[model samples]
Target: MPFDQPLPREVKVTDSASLFRLEERACDLSLNSRLDPAWVRANAALDGAHYLWPALWNSLAHRPEVPRQLRCELLITLRAGDRVVSWLDVLPADFNPLPRVTSREEGMQVSQLLDRAPSVREWLLREGGGSGQQ
Candidate 1:
């Protein structure tokens, strides 16, 4: 589906976590919306990978210009049977870090998270994963 495709109803986001969970849930509702939580974990350029994944997702889901290659990888990973129960599960067991969006401001948190995602940066470079493709 295109980014412009509207769902039947909108998810109200009262907080960053809620917004994150809603987007994650949306990913499961359709293959067109699925994301590779593992790839987000490994490639996001954040100190606390666990929290930033959802924040980034919530932010990007609104935008129209997500890199085609990144979208393809997210969809491809789903077909490979990579299931993510929670963003928490994406982190290493020893990874104990505070939430990135403690202020409960979804927009600010989303901006900060996307600013730190290496894959987002790589996509911006237009090299498609800093190579021909990722």
Candidate 2:
């Protein structure tokens, strides 16, 4: 599938999981708050802040074809006083047949991320993608 084109009907994400993911992302996007010093301090670090988890999940689910060799970046911005800071996280995926097609590498990659939900949740509450750090 070409990046410029849309997902095919079979994987277009019409099911509950995909739809919910999209909704979650929308919520994350809408949850941005002004980053006051107190807010930053409460969060420990400005970089610790994220756009919300739903956004991250939705983002990943929305574009399920991230190239393995390439690093993916998702940026979330916060307004701290007069400064707007950006936090970046990665959503790594491999869209090739490695160790042959239908291999477990892809599954493991996704599973590894899913296992880090605590960090991802914190991230969702704080910059955008689920990684705890920028």
Candidate 3:
């Protein structure tokens, strides 16, 4: 999906290999979105066990051209088999990813974080987000 497109709410993967692919896709998307690749390489890390992997991109917040309302963070959810494993946060420069949380409570926390951003909240309210396309 294009950067201008709406983000997906969740993504499903059957195994660790698929999860790794998802991480790569997320990183590629972030780079394509104009996030600094070098910064991403330096700051982005893979955490959690084989069932879950969350990736975050926070470079956009540093770009002045990006609007405040739209500067809301972005997250990509990762699932392994029948369970939700982790989430990726594509955040603004000013914000940091929330500490890793168990999959059970992640959905609610993601909602809370997105709600903190005006534009993101409106997008979620306007259109139910989905797991973004590869």
How far out, in Å, is residue 110 in model 3?
1.7
TM-score of predicted structure 3 = 0.27
* Candidate 3 backbone collisions, by pair: 8-130, 8-131, 9-130, 61-93, 74-90
TM-score-wise, the better of 1 and 2 is 1
Model 1 residue runs over 4 Å out of place are 1-27, 31-34, 45-127, 130-134
Model 2 TM-score, all chains together = 0.21
lDDT of 3 by residue, 34-132 (tens): 222332232223332222222332334565554222122333222211112123433322122323344756656655644453332333344474323
Q: Which of candidates 1 and 2 is the stronger one according to lDDT?
A: 1
- The digit string of per-residue lDDT tens for model 2 on 47-120 reads 42222111121234444453212111212232332222222221222211112213357444433433443432
The worst-scoring run of ten residues by lDDT in candidate 2 lies at 7-16
State the lDDT at 89 in candidate 3: 32
Provide the global lDDT of candidate 1 against the true structure: 0.31
Q: After superposition, how far is residue 125 of candidate 1 from its true place, in Å?
A: 5.6
Error of 3 at 56 (Å): 18
lDDT of 3: 0.34
